[model samples]
Target: MRRVAMMRATFPDALVTGHEPLIPAMTNDPKDRHVLAAAVRADAAVIVTTNLKDFPSAALAPYDIDAVSPDDFLLNQLELNRIATLTCVVDMAHARNRPPVRPVELLDRFSVIAPQFAEEAKAQILNQSEPSPWLIHQRREID
Candidate 1:
């Protein structure tokens, strides 16, 4: 709830409510129904979640939505925009100022949560030479 509150605070207009009207028993798990309801309400293109089994492609295909694991999602982002993704990861590492996390340490942490994404990201970061348009835009926005 605290993290939700922080996200709400950060992106006030991005958060959607009134999902109750869209509620349906889309999944076997009652607890996961809310996730489907929210996606329906928002008309999301994709639902990024670790629990891919709960959101089978057959179930989401009807709604023109696909459920993707966080690993796959991050890997897609890394492949599409390697420079921006690498910059984001490096920025995240620097943000852990309490212990001053190194980029390798951050990648190591990601290995536990999303091993495929961590491996791909590390490879992309090491091989990438040119800055992506996304990274250039992000830097401009920050500056």
Candidate 2:
């Protein structure tokens, strides 16, 4: 099972559930389709998954399940957790097994992939008005 650390911390009151392994269809099994179906049955609005192609939004339209990528899911989590999206980006960049980024250069790096989101992330970081790395990492989220 995925740790989903952010979700656990932010949504302490949320009713999070996961299904046991079930045999899926030959073409559909092992895809996000099974998870999406379960979420649909549970009346969930969003289906968070790393495999975006497997959980194409078109297939989930009937169930109103909007498939979101891991990055997007993490950004949404940051917004809800009161942790600046930029801070999360920086953390993600550093946490990655590859190269680490300078905290000051976060916007420069993230803008390449998501320019608008980078701006929003910067705004959230600047407006928070403090430079505590620990505070940036540890947020007390409200549901």
Instruction: Evaluate all candidate structures by whole-model CA lDDT and list the values in order.
Output: 0.75, 0.57
Instruction: State model 1's lDDT.
Output: 0.75
**TM-score (C-alpha, index-matched) for candidate 2:** 0.43
In model 1, the runs with Cα more than 4 Å from the true position are 25-28, 127-143
Candidate 2, residues 38-126, lDDT tens digits: the string is 67556788876656777665576766668776557656766686455545656665564546555435665656655555666656655
Which of the numbered candidates is closest to the native, going by highest TM-score?
A: 1
**Candidate 2 residue spans exceeding 4 A from truth:** 1-30, 83-143
Cα lDDT for residue 103, candidate 1: 69
User: For model 1, how does the per-residue alpha-carbon lDDT over 74-134 read when each residue is reduced to its tens digit?
Assistant: 9899789767788888788867887887766788799976899988776655444774665
TM-score of each: 0.79, 0.43
Candidate 1 positional error at 35, Å:
0.5
Please report how far candidate 1 places residue 20 from its true position, in Å. Answer: 1.1
